[model samples]
Target: IAVMTVLLIVVGLTACGKSTAQDLQSNKWYPNQKGQSYKTQFNKKTMIIESPLMNVNANYSVSNTSGKEYLKVNTDDEKNQKLELTQISDGYKAKAINKPAKADDGLGSFE
Candidate 1:
């Protein structure tokens, strides 16, 4: 009886731990798909953004309506900004509605 109980517990745990490829694929979020969206909040001041084929960490909210995707970012030191990304044949094109102010801070660099 003890051996059978242990075997049953082990089997149950193993089953719970195993995830098939189909299960993994189903859980993945595809941003390019119409009506499909995702949101990630890192903290009160930071968030992780995901669009059809892009990902960025910022203080923003992302949404899609009528097959159009939009990204809105807000910062304490800067004015609120919004951008629209349109899916093209090859990739996405971004158009900013209100251009953000440039900062000389060395937070980012170009190689």
Candidate 2:
């Protein structure tokens, strides 16, 4: 019984953690301040700006009248900083911008 309880607790915690992460990703935007622009198209008639340059490492799941889309900015240590762009229109456009990695004293890692 004790073992079962512990396992349940672990699974619950893991599930909660994943849920939190998804929420964060869905709403990740740093330069989320006012007046900055980050525009991506939802279709021919709709354009959405999930965040701004100030939103340095924000992730977002954008849904518009057309469809759903995802965006995430890369900021992991040991990896190059880049703007991870993703869009799915008639086809799709996905790419990254390469930039020099920053020094963080070896205490951080990118994912």
Candidate 1 lDDT by residue in tens digits, 1-111: 999999999999987862322232333333332344554333434545465576555575556679676655665544456667555554344456554622421111110
lDDT of 2 by residue, 56-80 (tens): 2222333322433333332333233
Residue 90 miss distance in model 1 (angstroms): 5.9
> Which residue pairs in model 2 clash with each other?
28-58, 28-59, 30-55, 31-54, 31-55, 76-110, 77-109, 77-110
Tell me the whole-model lDDT of each prediction, alpha carbons only. Answer: 0.48, 0.35
Candidate that would win on TM-score: 1
Candidate 2: segments with Cα more than 4 A from true spot: 19-21, 32-79, 82-99, 103-111
lDDT of 2 at 73: 32
- Clashing residue pairs in candidate 1 are none
Q: How much is 3 displaced in model 1, in angstroms?
A: 54
